[model samples]
Target: MVKGAFDGVTVLDFTQGVAGPHASMLLALHGADVIKIEPPEGDWGRALGELKGDHCAHSIAFNRGKRSIALDLKSPDGIAVVKKLAAKADVVMESFRPGVIGRLGFGYEDLKKINPKVVYCSISGFGQTGPYSKRPTVDGLIQAFSGMMVMNKMPDGTPWRQGMIAVDVTTGLYTFQALAPAIMRQFRFGEGCYIDSSLMRAAAAYQGAKLMEWVFSKGNPPVLYMPAGSYKTANGYIMLSAMRPHHFRLLFELIGREDIANDPDLQSHDNRIRNAAKIIKALNETMPQKTTEEWIEILQPKDVFCERVNNYTDYLQHPHVKATGAVDWIEQDGMGALPVANIPGLPRASEHPPQQYAPHIGENGPEILRELSYSAADIDAMLSRGGVRAPAPAVKAAD
Candidate 1:
């Protein structure tokens, strides 16, 4: 077997839902052994969205390449098992609210005492301290609070959440970036660090530029460049970004609006922004005369930045996307084929026909317990007492 970047790393993942799970999933993708510890009922994400047997699309998407071990943390024996696993793990991640894991007796402080070099990470809504630290929050609330929703408001001025969970997903990326560095520090200096990551913080970081603009301008982000938004065409909408002077000139020339292109008042960046309304009105009248494809054919050769606004289906079927191998087609049981996206910085050749299915609840409990040196009788006692779970017996097909 070939070794990967994180081949020797073991991760104790006590996270559920998107943010934390996604961070650990990235590590797993790079070859860390991520042991996902869940409740007896499984990660709550397994119950979210459309379901197929024990898993949902949400769970399946974020949990590839991890093993599930359902343990009742309320039980003393279960807590001991978790501590034992933590003792041997290179990284530990949890998404519980502030102090939740500490109450469960497995916070960074506790884990560090046993394993001083453990890279501990905590993901939450408001972070580990503050008046709102204990207040419950999710991705949508973060979007609203961090100015993302306002920045993405409709042209009619009605605020709406971004169609996807942007904050959670971005927070996952931030978490992974933080963890990778912490692991490096441990190797260089024998120091394990505690990371406090929050969706609110990630949202702010993601929208730093827009937030700065809004603050400086004291209003909505001004159109710095004319012809930089979506325009309706005869068949569909096409996004345009003819920001540079030469590109703007080419766009107008392609549309046969050289009068507007040659206007001296529209030449400089400031003048163009000042005349935004006039430039947009001209595009509104002229673009609808041709189809999006026709405009693309005319403008692409001129280097005017433009593309047809693509829905998910169009994106999946795009020739460039396919040629670049940006998605993995995995045949999941019951779910048929799933198009899993390939994360950047990983080998495309090694990404597909996903190495493992999202595990069932308690799917790896027996194997993990055996590694912990528990006897068969000891494992049976823990199972009987509801402290642990073994994978459900596979259903045999009828002869």
Candidate 2:
């Protein structure tokens, strides 16, 4: 097999929760040596998964390609251990409240003196420099701040949070983008960089459409052309929109109602908005006659750009998804390989599999300290100083 891109890089992951760990996971997936440093209690993600296993499914997704070591930063020996690792590490990823790491004496300033080539990344909800930086928040808080909570309206007209930790997960991806370049620059430019990866910043990017409209249009969206949502088509529904004047024409053409296309009353963007109700009525009646499949085939081919609003299961099972290999399968503990969606440019082989189990809290302490070149006496002193912890054995996987 071919070697992966980041085969020799070493990343010391000090992040907890989703955002930071996710960044480490990406680095690990592509073949970096990601050593996840956790408190004696382990990452909270290890517990969030519904199952009682050491590896929570959520944690597994982001931690597959890493090793684990437990250290207590508050302890002098633990601080010494991590500082020693920092001296040798190329990248250090942490997701802590603003001043926490600095107080622990492992901040970028503190680490850079020991290792000038170390790229230190901080992932947090607000950012490292904001007044709210010290205030702890979760994905829900980020969604509310980013206005994503109301972007999608439920059938009940209630605003709801994004279904998953969209904020933390995407923020992780953003961190990777920031970290990788800095790592390269450290080698070429000879100085590492400090990065602040904020969930709010990442989530704000998701509002690009609304932001673009507000910027260019100089006010609220043409609620009149809010691309008035979904319409009924024969057989199944289609996500019909009359955003542009031309799309209206396409809608008319697709429905075999050319009269509306030429009508002066229905020609302009604003006019379509005024009459969206009537036009939608006609489209609703016409669309349901054909199956969603039929219209998707015929209209999309005609550049009408129509689609069925499929349920999650239906979308997952859709032939196009399978044909494109958009989803792949993974092995579960009790179950065999189960379907998992392949992310964009997702690894086919080089990527590590999802973690099957989290290391027992502090499970690898002795081994990790050994790799750090700590002598047995030194390691025991740290352990004695409350710098290290060793957990009980993990549930071994089947052979």
Candidate 3:
């Protein structure tokens, strides 16, 4: 079997919720040995959606191919165990509020003393320094603060948050991109660096183009083009991107609006924008004459840029998606069968099996402790004292 790019790497995941876990999970999917350290109740994500034995949709989705160790971080023994693991880890990722990890004695500065070459990444809502650094943050809050709500405002002028946790997910990807290079630096120059990534920064970066445009236009989008919006078809909506003059002309002609296409008053870009309401009213009345598919069929052949607005089900069952093997089906032990998206350019399904599902809290404690050279008695003692937790011992069949 071929090895993954991160096959020999080990990641110590001290994150919960979306951002930090997502980054570590991406590393795990690429073959990193990621040990997820969770609180005694497990990652809070385990309770996010429907739950089954410390597993939930969010947890399972972001925590595949990793081990879980539930420890009482306040306990001296628990702190020692984490430090021991950090001493040998290749990367450390945490999403604690600023200064919390430092108070816990596992901050990047503290861990660097134990493992100088460890690539440490810290993820938060805001960064480590700033008046708002300590403020609690989630995707919605960041979206509102980052002007994303304004960008997604409804036609009636109501600001709206994006349906998904865009900031958290994007921060995770940004964290991975930052840490991956730091890991390479360790191999190339034996140098490890601390990374500070935040949802605020990621959210801002995600809307970089829009933010710059807002500044340039003094808060309103510039009227540079026409026929660049979504229109309601007979059954559904279709978004059209006819920014160029030729494309706009083609769109008007295809829609059977020859008068609008030939109108001298609407020929210039500024005139078209100034008369947008008239064009929009015409489209709103005419577009609904044909269904979304009918519009796609007609417009696609005419080299017009238009596509039906598809929901998740439509996207999942799309022929092109299946043809590209974009998702994989797997049966997790406790979570049942689920569809997992595959990373592009990687193996569709690696040798990692269903047993690689998200683990119960402290499911791998004993095994991890054993790897740390702890004796059975010590492991039992830690479990007894509530310093560590492991799955119940297997039952033996009576003869």
What are the lDDT scores of the predictions, listed in order? 0.86, 0.75, 0.85
Better of 2 and 3 by TM-score: 3
* Runs of candidate 2 exceeding 4 Å displacement: 150-160, 215-218, 223-228, 231-237, 241-247, 253-264, 283-290, 332-336, 349-366, 374-387, 391-399
Candidate 3: which stretches are off by over 4 Å?
A: 350-356, 392-399
How many residue pairs clash per model?
0, 9, 0
Local distance difference test, candidate 3: 0.85
* Model 1: per-residue Cα lDDT over 269-327, one tens digit each: 88999988889899999999999999999998878899999998999999999999997
Which order, best to worst by lDDT? Answer: 1, 3, 2
Cα RMSD (Å) per model? Answer: 2.4, 3.7, 3.3
Give the range of the ten consecutive residues with the poorest summed lDDT in model 1: 390-399
Model 2 is weakest, by summed lDDT over 10 consecutive residues, at 349-358
Which runs in model 1 stand beyond 4 Å of their true positions?
349-356, 393-399
- Report the number of the highest-TM-score candidate: 1
As for TM-score, the candidate ahead, 1 or 2, is: 1
Per-residue lDDT value at 210 in model 3 = 89
Between which residue pairs do clashes occur in model 1? none
TM per candidate comes to: 0.94, 0.83, 0.93
Residues 1-399, candidate 3, lDDT per residue (tens digit)?
Answer: 457778889899999998999899889877889999988777887777777666777888888878988899999879989989999999999989999999999999999998999999999999999999999988999999999998888878899999888898999889888878888899899998899999999999888888889888988986557777888988999998877778778888998998888878778788888888878888898899999999888899988999889987898888988898887678766556677787775566534564347776778888999999999999989989997866653311111
